[model samples]
Target: MDRSKQLYEQDATDWQRGMYEDIKTTFRAPIVNWYFRSLTANEPAFTRYLWGQLKPLFQTRAFGRYAVSYRDTVLSAIEDGPADLPRYRRADTALRPAEWRELRGQLATFDVVAPRLALTFAVCDRAMHGDLPDANPEGAPSTAPLPPWLDRDRGQSVTMLEAGDVPGDLSETVDEIRAFHGLEEGLPSIYRCLAQWPGYLEPAWTDLEPILESEAFERGCRDADAVVDGHLEELPYTPRLSPNDLAEQGFDDETIDDIQHYVRAFNRGAVSKVLQTIVTYAATLDAGGERSL
Candidate 1:
């Protein structure tokens, strides 16, 4: 299977599409993330099993609080920093009122998904490193229902521009993003989507680039990692998708290695930083009130 290939929602089988719906519903967001789509593409069975293994992590009230805290911590980090994030408005950009609203809502969606991805990667990273959580901790977090207010349909469907689809003038912007995220090629879905609105993406990146490079952003990443770790410590139950666990479940060594490779790619430095950056961008738009948009 091509690691880069993804079984997007439209191309998925009926059953696979149903699983995607389950994921969206469980995550309380409208879109399936790229990580899961990639996983499903490469190995649907393993992806399904992995979802079952990790679903418990997201279902608990503790995880809900963790998600909220993760967003707050990222925002607080930005707020506490010396440079203020430029709060761009509809009037400031060339987008029509509807387009501006769509941009804000789309970013708001990313805000909701960011922390969830953080927790996903953190759990996978720890488990793969042979530091599995205790199945039965002495004082586990509550297994109560997730909070009702947690991102219930807050974002619109996510769409992104293909590499060829990106405008020529925005080449500098694309290159800067690729360089910042250390990508040899290709932009992340978030940036690709933002690229559809050059009016916003260009200026926003101009203001955001320097701040993302600052020591302050680095500190925020560290602080956000700590917040994720703190919540992982409070997990009510362990996730059973470690390498050993996968082997026991009859996955081949090659399959295990492939899983590890993908997990490490997303769980490493760049994904988390991008996740936090998305949150910071979304929070800025959110401060002005989504209703007014």
Candidate 2:
């Protein structure tokens, strides 16, 4: 076998092994388990639903690799510093007040909205390719066509985010994409509680009375096409929630403030650690490195 092919195979094998071990030991068995337990104690159904949602994320090699690659890309962008970063559209000007309010309402329903969309993408992508490892799924799949919702000039007026558009609220963007995929409704109440509580324990009883009583919200929840289209129509230009708004919506203000305070701390620490390990490995590649390449 060619030396380059041998090296590539070795690297792929090592990556797969390491990723599987890390996910099973660190992510699936412990962190995710604990997260679900804490967030979904009351909602057994929601807990089960979330596990179902995460099954593909845990099982798929493509998703595992994508997580690491996306982290690296973000770290690299951070290292490049603010001046070199691409200009993102200002959320304040991009969306009007009524539009922002609508987006917020959608976001309030995000727990159900996001995971469904992710599932749709996963299913569609897998169906198209027969569960084969994506040729280049580190970020977005280059071969897979953009979803129908994102097509430009389609009379839907959806915002098409460029590859580098870094929004202020990463979570919200994720939720919006989930909503676009028709996977965003009829999620179990426990899943809803998990969305509300996240790492913390949820309240024993959810006030489902409002949701059950509201004809409009219930109808919106039921109409999958309308919900998807509504989100798509507003995507072309929507405002991210401000920090105060985020706090009001139950995210930890102190944590967000602290992270904002030290924007590059993780890049300088965790990311640099990974890069240093890579450099050390590279240094050991003697003169034959060039020939091998």
Candidate 3:
């Protein structure tokens, strides 16, 4: 798979553009994530089919509650536990009011998408591995109707600095991010976006880096994974992403292998770490009342 490839929204075909719009609407965010974009680039038909199969997992009230729970899990751990770091606030930086607002809005987009991505990875990872439950577990919760306005109108489209374009002043921070995520080259999209506000991203990473390395943060990631595992049976629609299923849907063997490899790569460690990092960074902005809860 061409991991670096991305199908930008402006470059999408009409059908792909429509799908992107539907994705933005369904995600309740203004931007499509790299996962969707990369999949679209690989094969628009499979991406469309995969999205349709996965959409129901995010639509139910149970999933909304899961999103909140996921947020609270990370925040409460940081706020009440041994992360033991002082919360960084908007005033901690010299950002102008407008810049702070834009920062907050962009961070909010990451915050909202974090949990959804976690769940998506969970479903896709398990499905790709044949680890999904064959039937609803005995005591799973109902796939309740989704509550309206859960994180609606909260976040703006996320914009990121290119990995190569990250300012030299933030090289240490960028290096730390790349090292921690085990990337030999290029930074994650979240860090690239955070790089846009070096003053904020620098201190935030300084404080967050230790916690991300801590036992508490590790526990939180495991807990986050369990939250999704615990809900596998309750998903309104299980993803039809197994190799056979994809092949049956006209995906070639190479595409199926690539999809599986990609899903597993994102699912294993990267997505949860990114998810938690986004949540922790966004929580810091709200710590001093600069952002709404």
- The most accurate candidate by TM-score is 1
Higher-ranked by lDDT: 2 or 3: 3
Compute the lDDT of residue 254 as modeled in candidate 2.
59
Best by lDDT: 1
Q: What's the CA error at residue 247 for candidate 3, in Å?
A: 2.2
Q: Give the TM-score comparing model 1 with the true structure, all chains together.
A: 0.93
Please give the ranking of all candidate structures by lDDT, highest first, separated by commas: 1, 3, 2
Supply the TM-score for candidate 2. 0.23
What's the CA RMSD for each of the models? Answer: 3.0, 24.2, 2.7
lDDT of each: 0.80, 0.28, 0.78
Query: lDDT tens digits, residues 1-293, model 2?
Result: 11111111123244333433443332322112122233233333332333443344423433333333322332243333322222212252255555544333322232212223323333322222233232323333322322222211211111223323433334453354234323343322223322332211111112222322244323323332233222222221122223543355455655445323232332222222222212111111110011110
Ranking by TM-score: 1, 3, 2
Model 3 over residues 1-293: C-alpha lDDT tens digits? Answer: 78789899989878899999998888888888888899899777888898888887778777776788887776666655675755655678889888889899998888878888888887887897788876462333346666667878789778888878999989988888888877788677788888899989888888888888887877777777677777676766657888788878888888877788888888885556878778887877862111222
Off by over 4 Å in 1: 135-141, 287-293
TM-score of each: 0.93, 0.23, 0.92
Q: Candidate 3 — which residues are off by over 4 angstroms?
A: 135-141, 287-293
How many clashes does each candidate structure show, in the order listed?
0, 1, 1
Residue 79 error for model 2, in Å? 1.2
